[model samples]
Target chain A: MGREIKLALVYRDMWQSSGKYLPRVDQLVRVAEPIVEMGCFARVETNGGGFEQINLLFGENPNVSVRKWTQAFNDAGIQTQMLERGLNALRMSPVPADVRKMMFKLKKIQGTDISRSFDGLNNPVNLANSFKFAKEGGMIAQGALSITYSPVRSIIMSIWRINILN
Target chain B: MAGIGRPVSIGKMVKGIRERHPDIIIQYHGHSTPGFSVASSLEAARNGADIIDVGMEPLSWGTGHADLLTIHEMLRDAGFSVPDINTKAYMHVRSLTQEFVDDFLGYYINPKNRYMNSLLIGPGLPGGMMGSLMADLENNVKSVNKWLVKRDKEPITQEQLLLQLFDEVKHAWPKLGYPPLVTPFSQYVKNVSLMNAIQLIKGKERWSMIDENTWGMILGRSGQLPGELGEEIMNLAKAQEREFFTGTPQDLYPNQLDEFRQKMKDKGWDVGQDEEELFEYAMHPQQYEDYKSGKAKERFLEDLEKRKAAQQGLTSVAMPQTSNSESNVMPQSMTIDVNGEKFKVQVAYGDAVEEAKAEASKEEPKPTSSGELEEITAPLEGKFYLTKDSSEIGIKVGDKISEGDTIAYIESMKVINAVAADKSGEVVEIVARHGDDIEEDDVILLLK
Candidate 1:
């Protein structure tokens, strides 16, 4: 119970959950040192998921952003993480296994130390593949379970349940 | 998990996961929506969760993850050895984030996403998707209201439409096999529900307008559904003759890393610092292409400027010109207005050429006859074009035209509005030539 709890500040998710755009690479660069100095976070989520797509929307090279931003954190003795959508691999549709593996390699080379990967449907097959690729590509793969609430036998569920019960 | 779980349920889940595999580390990621995430975080930590994902304020709470400062204090109070936060550094990061929100991104965020909506608990939509969902809901509501107004019916409010959509999602989720309401799948369910609501509003049947992507999700293209597809969708799929996939989703998307690498080679693009650029292209082909071409940034900045101007209550900038010499070589004088103050400015292209000025004077409009000729003045200030972009033929001398006829087109603000004739007449002479920048009340055509 006395163990030091590691806190990873989800910077990418904070903006994405609140607004439509991510801050420019220059803006992120300015704040990266201040974030490391905050002294509570063990890790900072640099980019992934919609991060690259949002950077493209701003007409900036996401590769450059990830490299410089993660380097800033790594230099400050803080680890960096990226959100990965398991089989989808940073996009909505399914990605080829070869490209998915290369994503982990590229992200790791860009200075990201961890990859927090999740399958939206909680498919174990997808998660297993993500962990294998991420670890093989030199990243600490943090498998995620997407949780949701489901009421027991509500009006809609009752109909399906009744058909089975009968 | 996505932070939507109750505290007790989260505790049980974390404990259960730890019990099953004691060596595996558990990190809890919960959202602050529906007011349960703070308690959920505490419960998870107590139940052997190794780490907690927290968001820094002023970007915390609302639909984002729980606040770092609050969670750290709470965890420390609960006897956990949480790390100390530098107050000054925290304050600086908070202000920097606020500055970003105020700068431009604030315009696109729905204020509703910043508050815990208890109403969302029933539909169980994830907090991360709530921001974009509300944005799409706002847009969809506007379109629906506009349609209703056109039909002379009572318009619905965003709140009303959102409630309807939630209801439809509740219905559709069960029908679509209750896939975990997460990214991609949650969006798929929300979109189909939104379409159903819109169709019913327009007096059309549900499932009348299903998109291919939604069909793909329903037919097992993403993966095997946990539950069964509803009878209606199944019947509709059968009627539409849509094929259902029984194979693994990844098998359908074979290895294409080499294909993308070859594409980057053909385009002569650098593979970047360890092929990161190529990875971006392989991931999102269209968006990466737009970014490489510089079109994305141009449009993004343009939209930001427009939104900023609108927020500042400024209309499109207009210059009040006093006069402009017809000759290109002459000094043109105009009035520049800044904050309601006017300053006279004169700009000269170059030293005046005598022969060039004479030629410009000669090109000026002349009377074809000494008789009374009617002047067809421009109704608005714009670039006067003798024909639309699609046409080449124009009104010429001696051409007969009828009243209410479109004699020429005037392009203003990218819209080509037809300039109609006031009375039927024969064109005696053309005054405003093609592509001429004519002002209001300027004679564009001479009629007889």
Candidate 2:
């Protein structure tokens, strides 16, 4: 028999995809609760990755929305995940190391089971601190390899391996 | 990065990583910038990537992430073990998601965004910027058409302008040291490139419309560039000459937890242990404050509804007329009704004399004994921010400031240019207040 693979579904892109399809926070909460309860996903990539920006853009309190979503996932007995941009965390720009640490700590506390961290440049050096912080904060640190093609792919491959091992 | 669209290369890369670190969990995040992310993702998985990032089919392709359905099917077809995702449930969710995508097509889709560009491989515009660049191109073309019409020249189509902009972006990338085209940085590159393209289209000299943010990036204020910036580019940037930050950019900004807390307190917001709200306020003060004050939320919802109505091909219901001009009036306080709620706003025009006198009275008296006071002028024309936060003790009258100390910041073209003191001396007076628009070489502060 083939090995059973766990499939994690990332709906964070839906926030962007929905574009004008933006439902109110309450509406999203109502619709997502049943879907999350279906219990099919190994992990639901539900929050973070511009959730704050969308909330802000739509005039919803991000904290409230995040809290509600996380709680819903928790109630459904499903682990929730988010993509963290290494040192950048939630903000567009690179935040202070202290701020990045705090963000991980807070997310963990708020019930973020896993943080799939990646740097845009695929720089392992940048991912190191975020990985450390995520582990320290008691969350699973899923290191992301930003897949890009290059003639000298060996250099990045080595870096990616080294980053994960370290 | 260059092999983004090449799946075989990605498979090789992933295989190499897998071979090196057998125990490490690998997730693949691919963008459909060059319209090859789905294939690339499957390649990554076939080689050894454990987790592949994929979006719903409705939001997939053309600069979006890889489609989940495609990834699942390809992985299964390759004889790889797959997850037991309920196909029926997944499709149900997708159907709902498609409804949302359909509603938002007007806001998200544009002519430029609808097509795949092979040229994107050279400039490497991030997936996130696709929609925005399309919107920017649309706006730019409209302006260009207007200009052409005024000049009695043939109006160029949006496609032509988009191609020109793409060409300019490719040219600008090397000049800007090829900073990773991501959020914040992507916007910076796009702005500089767009400005350059527009200026070129108008037959203006190169670097004639250099945005301050681009200037700052060129000076290494934003972050380190990937390559050596050319001497000519640096010389052109010197025209808007300002002190460039040599050290790490984050060093210039002090922690503002206490200041934000205080602001929250002053605003009568429920100051609690929520770091999330604090972080939101820290990153976007004005927006957060507006949200907290119950103004921005109302406006956003109203705007969103209007857009939604327009998207549905339904006529937008007329909103109650509120005087936009009254909102702009300064010193004159006015009560305006928005959605039946009245908000009293008092707008103070530039440097109210009474407020200035009151502030001067609060400060310590200036010393009489001094040499001739020298004026430190602004290096460029921009809005001067006195301090990053209210808690920050900026240079005031009778305060000793050192040479190269950042007394204020002049924000122009979305970049904050730190205003440093040329010579160390006691601040005799602060000529420019917070949010004051000062001209080039205007006196910002007086030093004795």
Candidate 3:
């Protein structure tokens, strides 16, 4: 029982329109920025395209671990698409009590309508790799990719594997 | 435990004490016996516990292992490091402290300690946990013959085995939390005996079922087995009480029958049918059938199913219910019916209650044709929640939400996601409600 790491995801909702994907750019920033600054995790898009939007955040060792994040939400009556991620990654194992109670608090700000299971989010690893290598980067492994921080040396594991673009 | 059926937990007590006395650094140590445990003691250490109480056994999470030596060995298999164990604590103490040994004997005989009460476990012996488990396994796994015939499904995964145990232990005593009491743990071992007992030792010629040597450690080295266990199980069967194992006497393997008898006797049962009668029953196929009508088996199963169904802290009465016919035991609003079974629907607990209130206060998003602008409010306090709003595909007005759908999100930082119906017909009017900062029992979306 090292210090229990509690990850709270504040994500952006995407609207589907005219047989195409529409990203809620404003809500993404609104929900995620404050959440990230608050020392929790949130998603951020580099540019356009709903396809690339999923890569905003995750860790390196494992997936976002919705099990840890969602039980608190579920137990507290907060809704989550955490279950959907069951197919994408191993759901987070059950956390202990005090941390469970704390994660339950952080989830308060992140709770919203779950659009789908596992959130069908993208890997930020590919986004960074694509930016680093341009068009050469392609066909990323969905689960292996993640949103990694360079200075803090943190990487939010991707729910899906990814082969970095390039 | 100082006394049987008293339900003691060193883990919870240690946690409570530590929270109050974070600095009470007592020189802590621990040891597990064959039937004794370090789980409770180790749990204490993890949560500010200092000393480890050494008794007799080793460590295996799911069901538990043979004796103390076996448990420690299994800990190595599970990737846990046991660097600090004092394997010879009792041996060293025995050599050096004659006075301490005298105190221990005095303590064992004091009668005030109630230590002797723990030695009376057996068939139909009221709270004979092993007996209870046998009855449970038989009850839950209906068609024992069919199950045995087809028992080779996926082997129970280590994680699954652990989680199942956690659920059962948690169920038996709600407040016990993660590291539950030994009573429930013992039952778990007994229930999964076939799965757990057959320890696969990697390079061994074959996985071995628990034999006499192991059984000695499981019950207690000093406790009766070949004599006592045999007597207890036989007497329990004779008494027509709930029994987990049943089969043709001819089907019984040589060591199995003896092992079973010893286990029964260890709990103080009487194998009165006699060795000759047992051997006679063991060899004759037709005579065994004459005694096997199984009306008792059916009754045992019915009682067990009832217990499992009502794991939620309340004594359950066996009554079949469907969604249509309602329970009149409680008022309609106060109780909720899930498929005819009734549960008292109380207000949401902890952060959920606060989040529910916050949902009621949230601001409503701009109204659209399919998406309703009516505010979804929190019925109680809870952390605001979201159902994995993956790339937001907005909800439509015609979509109907069952009772627990994600209608809106709320959080006083511990948010609760209020699941409301998407379509209660048309969103007739908009409330500045979609994300309005709401409070207790506030109105969310009016489903008009």
Candidate 4:
């Protein structure tokens, strides 16, 4: 068949990461066809992270936007995914289990096909709920470990140094 | 990881994950901020990453992720079965993005964020937080410089302020237990660092302006940190009587969906075709309220129009007016305030302008203080100090001083403002102590 899909263009986050606002739903609709025609991204990230918050800030109902926009991508035979904060679940603080489950259920109904969940601390416990709930809502559960770099430290050397200091 | 990792590290991590769980698919989400995106993407893919996240042009690189075209092409070149990106559609999307930027979003974007910063390697803040970080830097620099200008001090540059803030972030990250520099945690680290930098710049000590949210992170309410809290922070927490948290962070926030549902019903808000609206409301209560009340829209529209007007003003040139009179020229000096910052502009015309400029440059001899007792008063209400530290006392009783000499300093909101003498005189009486709280027009000394 055609080349296997291995890329998910995070369109919403691009707008947020580059500037301060997301594209309006109409703008998203206009670009969705072209993005699908490109045949590059297997999935497109329509919303996640700051999506709902930003939509609220713009005085738009994010649910409406998500439904309309993700529908466009799903109709085109492309999978639609959202970024989910593990434990936080689209928020800065820990979200309740029932509310978090409802988020996945509602998002799946709103045409979202996948939930790429990540925990800031890379804590597995925080992400366990997301895996369970996303699958329960008939969405593909993708777990991501937040990555960062640190100079490799020798723990044994450190312990020896600590003992010497003590 | 908030910051990007080296390609080798990413490859190792991906390979380890792939080996441990062959059925699991790995996706590496890395930012292009540190200029290591292309290499890392390739490494991740080679090491068994099933998907790689990327962004489109006009929104790629800088604080955003690497572009899809580059990653696709690179992966294919490296012999991966990646799908071909339709060049025509890519161009169309690119053009559409540019159009969006030109329409209004360009005014909000900081141009500095368009390029990669190697310095981001130190702080490792993810691309998501970089937008606000740059914006905060711009606002804080303007504020600090304005305060400095009022005290007749030289203005600090954005680079200088950013560098100090970066250093502070590096310092604060480990001190606060090396929480992964991501959302909520990253923001907390950044806010604390920013506050510390501003305070340090104002001659105040670090951790002097830690807010409650930062305290939350420090107290371990968010979660377990990767490292121990610094002794200084622990001591401060002890002094504040804030207890440490060792329980599950998520359990602290119990199930509150029913509460939110009841509240939404009271407000007559729809729960959407699904319950997505309720979820949004529950997640962000204040923002949702503002959105429903139309306050957010009003504020956003006002800000957009203000930015648009400013752009138009900057672009429109002043056309010279044609006059019938030939000698329509004169020497003038005036002060103009731009966005609340004052600037003095001098305009001079005629052949003798050079000579006049030279003549004006010469300083006129000043009459010494009207030969009377002069009181050196605090220019603002703040803590007054006679010296920067104990090692040096700037002025004592019976010390001679000239006009414009910094007789004392007044610190307000952590910013130290030098109080200068209005006229030349000998210090006759010292009235304020080194650490006394003083007010505007409060005399620090009597000079004669």
Give the interface RMSD of each candidate. Answer: 5.7, 3.9, 29.6, 5.4
Q: Please give the distance, in angstroms, between residue B91's alpha carbon in candidate 1 and its true position after superposition.
A: 0.8
lDDT of each candidate versus the true structure: 0.76, 0.63, 0.28, 0.73
- What DockQ does candidate 2 have relative to the true complex? 0.31
lDDT tens digits, residues A1-166, model 2? 2433445666765444323224556655655654564445566776676766556755778777767767777777777898777656775555666666766777777767898786654555567777888889888887765443223345465465455546
**Residue A130 local lDDT, model 3:** 23
Q: Give the range of the ten consecutive residues with the poorest summed lDDT in model 2 chain A.
A: A14-23
Worst 10 residues of 4 chain A by lDDT: A157-166
TM-score of 2: 0.72
Candidate 4, residues B211-286: lDDT per residue as tens digits?
Answer: 4556766776666677888999999898878998878776777888888888878878887666777888788776
Q: Model 1, range A27-143, lDDT digits (tens) per residue?
A: 888889889888888888889978988888678888888888888898888989898888888877778988899999888888999999888766666778888999999999887
RMSD of each: 15.4, 11.9, 30.6, 13.2
- Whose lDDT is greatest here? 1
For all predicted structures, in order, the TM-scores are: 0.75, 0.72, 0.18, 0.76
Query: How far does residue A63 in candidate 3 sit from its true spot (Å)?
Result: 19
Q: What DockQ does each prediction reach against the true complex?
A: 0.43, 0.31, 0.01, 0.37
Superposed by TM-score, candidate 3 places the C-alpha of residue B289 at a distance from the truth, in angstroms, of 70
What tier of docking accuracy does candidate 4 attain?
Answer: acceptable
As for lDDT, the candidate ahead, 2 or 4, is 4
Worst 10 residues of 1 chain B by lDDT: B348-357
> What share of the reference contacts is kept in model 2?
0.24
Tell me how many clashing residue pairs each candidate has: 2, 3, 121, 3
Question: Clashing residue pairs, candidate 2?
Answer: A149-B3, A149-B4, B331-B347
